[model samples]
Target: GIFGARPYKTFYVENDQVTFATLDPNFKEAVKLSADWYKKGLIDKEVFTRGWGARDAVLPTNMGGMTLDWFGSTASYNSLSTGQIPGFEFYPMEPIQIKDGVKSVTVGRNTTPEIGWGISAASKNPEQAIKFMDWWFSEEGRRTWNFGIEGKHYTMVDGKPVFTDYVLKNPDGKGPLKVLQEVGAQVSGPGVQQDAEYEFQYSNDIAKQGFEMYMKDGNTKRPLPILKYSPKDIKELDKIMALVNQTTEEYMQKWILGVSDVDADWDTYMSRIQQNGIERAKEIVQQGYNHYNSVK
Candidate 1:
């Protein structure tokens, strides 16, 4: 139900001015431009039908002489330098303007803490479970989980934890970190908090870049209103959302793959969505938003 329009972060040659149509622009112009790019072989043909990995098949081995990528941040550049594409170069672009003269980048809010843990209600040892949870959050536990045994997995670097060469290289077929994760020895639960230093100590350049991107773009984007719903409301919303999303995915794919003409088929697709009560769904979302705002 949330349908806020945003600009795309484009990767182009240095000093090139981007000219792609915005999401809310006239459909004719947008379709025409998109089709033109496809016809000219400038845009990847698989973009409409397949994902980036598949599309990468068409890229020249040397990346078609492209030196820039629209990535989250410089940290991303560092992280992505793995052996997948040896000697690949990446340059980050500043946020740019799009339609309606709006300048912004898209981002998602930080996930809530309770995203990944749950205790079975039928557990016989609930007290033990609670005690274990408490112990897991203790400082000693955090250090053990994040840094591993001081000398084995990591070493102290001026009092900061640094991964050993073996861990960094992921030397074995399955690294020590992966083994720890499988055993649930880390903060694998929702709502669990860890020290920022500990988190950063284990993060690679890609993670740092992602954090920088989020901070930078989050400061400029129009804030999305948070919403909450009642149980009944949630059930109804989920049902309607599934239908709407299915419809959107179908039509978007059809349009991109040239299976359906955008000009002639778009109105029909929109009308079908209207019949599915997208407007009512939107109203329900708005009500939730209003309620959440009121509580805030």
Candidate 2:
């Protein structure tokens, strides 16, 4: 597709500005392109209801074509390459430029780390919980969660963790994702940061190459740092965004699908939500950034 379909939210928070992408010239161009693609049937007809899972299910059977996905997860295509999909191929593509030289990959949403775990205040097994918590932060536990059983899931080469062929090419003809899932221990819960190195392991050659190429120009936009929020602040933020977010999603769907005219409807959409809850929410987010910077 000529357009990048991301940055879909009508609102974007950058530094101190809370801006509208619906009114952006570059983003409008992308929307126009997406609409054109939809008209041509080049875009999936069922895009609004369908997703990667649906596509993945059929792609293994050679029904459709390519899709954009996370760089880290792109290496899991070996499972689908078991000669079932005929011409199904997988590769990671570097960030591409869209109309007006808009970079496909940039400091944008979906790059932030957010999920975490916490113990209950009134737990029956406090001691067991404490022991497990300690183990989660341990190097050995992290290793187990990340690499799985070292010898079985991966091996050491020149003191670097090398994922074995069992992962690279599964003996049971399993795919990379399946093999890695079986062997690796996940450190995603509570206290562990995902080992960034494992993102490249046991994946295909093209994935590594693509990652390197994409990194040539740093394109990821990080979200605001974690900040303390009072319950009142949380309530205020939620109230502001709820309607705005819903309106954005609905309008976005209509605009992209040509249900509503992007040119005619965009301004009205912006104005409708402009003074709504957006400004105060923007202030709160900016305050979070400001607080984080001050502490740092």
Q: What tens digits encode model 1's per-residue C-alpha lDDT throughout 92-118?
A: 334444455444344343443424445
Top candidate, metric TM-score: 2
Cα deviation of 225, candidate 1, in Å: 4.9
Model 1 has an lDDT value of 0.52
- Computed on alpha carbons, the lDDT of every model, listed in order, comes to 0.52, 0.65
Backbone clash pairs for candidate 2 read 79-175, 106-219, 107-220, 107-221, 108-221, 145-185
Clashes of each: 4, 6
Candidate 2: 10-residue stretch with minimal lDDT: 1-10
Q: Against the correct fold, how does model 1 do in TM-score?
A: 0.59
